[model samples]
Target: MERRRSSSCKMSLCKSASSSLGYVDSSMDVDCGSGWKYAPQVVLVKIYSFLNDTDRAIMARVCRNWSLAFEAGCLWRRRRFEMGGYRARTAEFQASGFAEKFGQHLRYLTISCNHPSLVTCKIFQRAMEAFLPKLQRRAKLKEFRFSRLEMDRYWRYEQLKEKLILTLTRFLRQQFCLRVLDLSYSQFYLSAGLRIIESVGLSCGHCLRRLIMEDIFHSRLTVYSGLRYKRAISRFTNLRTISLNYGYLSDDVMEILRGNLAGKLKTMRVRVYRSDPHGHRITKLAWNGLRRACPSLKVKFNFESIGFASDIIPILVAGIPLYELYIWTGFDDNSDWRLSSILNHVAVNFKDTLEICNFEFDNSTEMIDDALFRLTQSCVRLRSFITNAVLLISTIQNICELVEQRKLDPRTFHITACNLSDLEWAELAYLQEKYANMADERSIDFRLSSDLIVESRHAEF
Candidate 1:
């Protein structure tokens, strides 16, 4: 009898799992309150939310109610259209017609320029052109993102770039109130970048909140216009968050941001790239003034270097609160970086408020164990620690411990490129399963698998 009951219980759990996976469908329509076919609109919409975009698209074909729920305006507000290997190949996506259909519904829109086909396709271009008019009229659009656009050796590169900039400018000028705009890694010319920001500022001014315009591409001929930058940035009077490349930021720009009141400015992200020889021109005094004005403001600093961190780390770490830091360096052919320089200061100094820490190192470099320990142990608010460098087994364990202790708040420790042996992976899997059982028994909500994203096959198990 006990064995039969156990089998019944297992069957029920499997059914529950299947339900959550969201494949249940039947076409026998009934009255609004009769049965599953006639579930309330809210309930149906909520169920639709659980299914991913692909599944939702497939499910939409199941029934009229399901189709309506899938097309409900609420779900379409925040949209990200990118062509990855999966998305590009998916015939059912109808990505070509997305802009024409859902232009008015989009409050937050993110489109990737990294995909060659999506950006270059004539159908997509026409759709975008049609879409921009809808946004212009609606004026409800709040976020616009075009990320990972880089130059190449295509014959019509210059011609296409000019056309793209014109189209982008037209789109930007239409939106009157945008909260977030990301143009990072786009490698846009200074003039073109200025024009885009100027368009937003001319329209969006007071309503604009976060602007990410760093790592802008520069060439020998394209001039760097501080005046143009000042003109464009000063128009946005209520910016709460901003990310700008340090190479172009003059003292005037910093002063403009300070602007006597520091209106709504809470977060500042600065990227220091190695291409520019001048380094950062903002003085220690300007940093101090900004810190004094906005004591609660925290900085997310990304420093990219071929060798050690640029000399500006001292000036930066001195005044503002270092909330997050990412160091991407070639690590020089010289084997080791002494902790005293940047790592020790980061691990020891900003332990209280430092939440996100990431390091992208070249192949030859390995993170020192001591630094990882200090980072793991000290950072009480540390939410993320991601790296490409291969970490030691003990180091990985320390990160796991961090997550286990901070079970209430979700933390992420990701090793993106660590080539772990099968044996090592198996050991980690064992520990993972052990923790899973313990977490379940104790009713601890956070599990290590979701938070600790390592390359392991037994992750689901």
Candidate 2:
């Protein structure tokens, strides 16, 4: 009777084991399906935010629910439209409901008409008209960037230019909450440019922080018109950064900015490309005015013409606490002594505030070892030091030693020259390897490149 009971228990144990295996097999065979389709809407939206335009389109086609969620999420907050000559189909536009969606959610909008297909003036005008009502409802809009790429050719068409100006003026008048307005590379009549400036000054003056008006031109306007527009720009009291590039900065404009912006302006970038020497002078009065008005202004002045350094450098060294200094000498007119003196003066005077120092000399005749060493030693806050001058290996060693001793954290240290030898490159590589191995908690980057190519990394030539 006991033997029979033991055999019966063994049989029952085998049956239980087989039933457990069968249960596991059946559970594995059950298809769970796509888990993403069942995810919460917020989780789906967060995932969709990482996708690019093409990827988002592909994801939308994955299923119906994903398409709806993608259309309603934060992924559509920033929209870029490439305006070619062709108009979007009416049915497609209506179905997409672009205006309704964008008006409710768009914070940034970029409209580009610089394609090869060449959108006609009338088509662009009609498109702007169709989108205007939607744009008017963008209460949360903060940035508006309009590019009429290669305006030199596009502006030749009178109808296109006029329509663009009208549309832009209308757009500007309504953007009361805009913080950034970039009209770079877009040609507009002097009147239209002034009107846009006036609209921003009156409507969004309290909120506007950055205004870029690069490559703006007025067909036959004189310096008087620029002076008038300067007064309009002055009304933008909260502007922190302003860039007037490519044929915009005249003496009168600079003077007006000095008197108007005063302590409010933080950065001013002026780039002029005229071959005539007279057009590039930012006179002593203007320089002195800027120095007095905005004592802590960061100035980036780039000109193809020479001879303004003598007038500008002393003022920069004297009063203004420059944060960034970029001097691109287009001509080989400055002496090595003059360049060294400028660097030394900056290292001594602006040491507390200077963060970026970029110098592109016409040639590599100057050896800036001493000036650079002094700068690295003095400027504890210097984050980026870039130069096109040839540097000695010993100088680089000194800089590294100073930085290590002071525990300085510089983001970028780059030297561009044609004279860096193989020995110097090897030394840089050794230093980089040593720094990488060191357990020191500091970020130090050393880069050496030739004049023909600009590359970075552990002694990557």
Candidate 3:
């Protein structure tokens, strides 16, 4: 009995010793630092660094490995919320607490919607409330462009009027570091006319630098009232550049703009619509306004009506110091306006700053040819002569000759006729041959329709 007891005691002692040894080894392994595992925080950062905002947000929800990826603030840098509808598989919605996840990194935000309804506005407001606070807190957003898309062009005229007030209030009131605000293509009608003018004119006081009003063709009430100018022009102390379509400011409206914006105007672009009998007055006003408002303003007036250019050219030459000139047939049946004398006058007055001299006409190729011949003979510093379909083959040849001889200061001549096909190839070939014969120093870009096929054949002189 005594021997058996001693043997059992020895076995017990050995088991205890082995257990102690294992514990000590385990402690040593942990302290050695080589056995440290990667935590969720580190892994999330690595994932964010590799992917874009939308992708990163998606992957973060996949599993435990990705949850932390979204929590890291840098993943939400640029937030683009295109209103209306985006396909589900392509665009991600903020339904899954996305705003709370990465709102801090939004530096640039663009909000686009097509004639948003009341319900749509509410939903947008909710989303904005969710994300914008975080963005404002985290990033100093520098640029914001809100585009209100009009599908039918005329369908949303009434809807825009009702909603524009609320929309502008929300946008301007929101504390953002916005430098450039572009509100284009929002159809203006009588219902929303004065409100829009008031909202933009009043809200953009100290914040705006550049303003562009395009294609504002709406109700006659707003167009005739022209009351919007009261607020619109008053807030332009810091404005350096302005571009307006023909519909917004016709020739007849120049009488109203004299004391309003004349002193501050710097660079102006007037797109004249010729159909209105008031067009002549508008053209005259533009010339007179530029001369009076800005002593040395650079004007780039696009003549949309050929009939009016005859009257407008003289006014422009006498009134303002035009830096560039681009003339084209307005959106109607082609009407040829003799441009020789006008071209000569431009070349004579603004000799130093003449950059782009372009003419776009539709038909009567012979008339355009005569215009080109006269321009080539008289104007010495012509840069770019862009002729639409109305230009003839002979005109192209003459312009090419001047370009090849180095007599014309321009580097390119874009000759476009009706359509691009083999139909106009004969004329193109003839012009190419003439250009080659002249040993042209400057290469010309030739377009039979719209496709550019060859450089000037006379590019060696």
Identify the candidate with maximal lDDT.
1
- Model 2, total clashes: 0
Model 2 C-alpha lDDT per residue in residues 206-260, reported as the tens digit of each score: 7898888765544333433355676786677777888876345556776767766
Provide the global lDDT of candidate 2 against the true structure: 0.62
Clashing pairs in 2: none
* Candidate 3 vs. true structure, TM-score: 0.63
| lDDT agreement with native, every candidate | 0.62, 0.62, 0.51
Write the residue-wise lDDT of candidate 3 on 1-461 in tens digits: 54333223222222333233322121122322322223456765875678654354344334443443445555555666655543211222441233444444555566676555654554554554444554444555555555664422424344544454455544454533455555555545533544544555565545555565543444222353355554455554544556655456544355444555556556766555454223323454466665676675667777655544466565464555566677766545544454555565665566565666776654443244564566565566656666665555556666666676677756556666554344455666655555553434344453334434534642211
Model 2, runs deviating above 4 Å: 1-39, 53-68, 71-73, 82-97, 113-134, 137-140, 148-150, 187-189, 218-227, 245-308, 311-317, 331-338, 377-380, 407-409, 421-441, 452-461
User: Residue 295 CA error for candidate 1 (Å)?
Assistant: 1.5
Candidate 1: tens digits of C-alpha lDDT, residues 90-199: 21133334444555677888876445443344333444555555556654788888676653222135666677678878878878878888887766776777788788
| TM-score of structure candidate 2 | 0.70
Candidate 1 has a TM-score of 0.67
Candidate 3: Cα lDDT at 446: 39
**In every candidate, how many clashes are there?**
0, 0, 7
Whole-model lDDT for model 1 versus the true structure?
Answer: 0.62
